[model samples]
Target: LIADEYIKMSDGTYPVLFVANKGRNVLLGREAVMRKEKMQTNQIVKDDELFERLRALRRKLAQEQGVPPFVVFSDETLREMSGKVPLT
Candidate 1:
């Protein structure tokens, strides 16, 4: 289970939790966001073409380096790069 701020302490401790915006007092609990039997996947493609290209490049670099895909760079990192670096 995972949670953020505003979670009731009575809910018990979770193996993993990430609390953000604590200063502003934002809280969330795993059960509040998800069901135990259900799994949620993010399939929404905000930028499908660009994201696919970046994923392919990341996979190629990882194979060449003989490391895991994330070792080359995380998807989040690549997305950030896309925003910071303009295509030339």
Candidate 2:
């Protein structure tokens, strides 16, 4: 793990357990925060409006690219995007 500091033993082995600060809004990126929430709860709540909008965008992109909507954005990705309600 890349860190600000680590120690080397006499045997020249470097090993340490590190955990990204949990639930600290300043510590994790938006996706990482939401993903951690999902992992803990086993479910993620999605915003319906964002979900529909993303679906429409994905459908359009898929048609233009001649691929399936899931190829443009999988269901899991859509769900996460919905949770974030990203405008872009």
Candidate 3:
């Protein structure tokens, strides 16, 4: 896991556990990961069938709960779920 904190000395940084634990890659901040996830979602949401199905599902769920579709689930979340289809 990436540990985020302020450093007392110079440079001002904490540490990530990965390098110490033999993990090769270091994914930096939450914002960076979110940006990357959004990029991946772009590809999934482009699928016509999946998009339509999720749109319908989102509408139905929102109506049942008396809330907006976006409140039920954002397009990105629906796209991510669509990408991982037949979820278990």
Candidate 4:
């Protein structure tokens, strides 16, 4: 039921419909509009788990410093870190 231009378009933006049950499974672009054929749910779950862990750490640090958790590290940054899982 959600409608928004999820991707950038040079000509003009068009509304894209997100599937109710599939969780962002809809694909919208110049080519076509449809549901994504492949979904990496396992990797996403792992990344989400890591993101939660990072968030917990951020919360703890923020509490100690008397600042917001996002001040320690934004959610977008944490999400990227979780997906990459940098060794260093």
* Per-model TM-score versus the true fold: 0.42, 0.48, 0.48, 0.45
Local distance difference test, candidate 2: 0.65
The superposed Cα distance between candidate 3 and the true structure at residue 85, in angstroms, equals 1.8
What is candidate 2's TM-score against the reference?
Answer: 0.48
lDDT of 1 by residue, 1-88 (tens): 2244532233356544344444124334333343368687654445667777899999999999999999988987777665555557
Q: How far does residue 44 in candidate 2 sit from its true spot (Å)?
A: 3.5
- TM-score of model 4 (CA atoms): 0.45
The number of the candidate with the highest lDDT is 4
Ranking by lDDT: 4, 2, 1, 3
How many residue pairs in model 2 have overlapping backbones?
A: 0
CA lDDT scores, all candidates in order: 0.64, 0.65, 0.62, 0.67
Q: Report the number of clashing residue pairs per model.
A: 3, 0, 0, 0
Model 4 lDDT-worst window of ten = 21-30
Task: Residues 1-88, candidate 3: write the lDDT tens digits.
Answer: 3343221223337633324221222233323222234343236354669878989999999999999999999987887787777746
Model 1 residue-pair collision total: 3
- Candidate 1, position 43, lDDT: 45
- Residues 12-82, candidate 4: write the lDDT tens digits: 37654434433334433334356658865533434777888999999999999999998999987887788
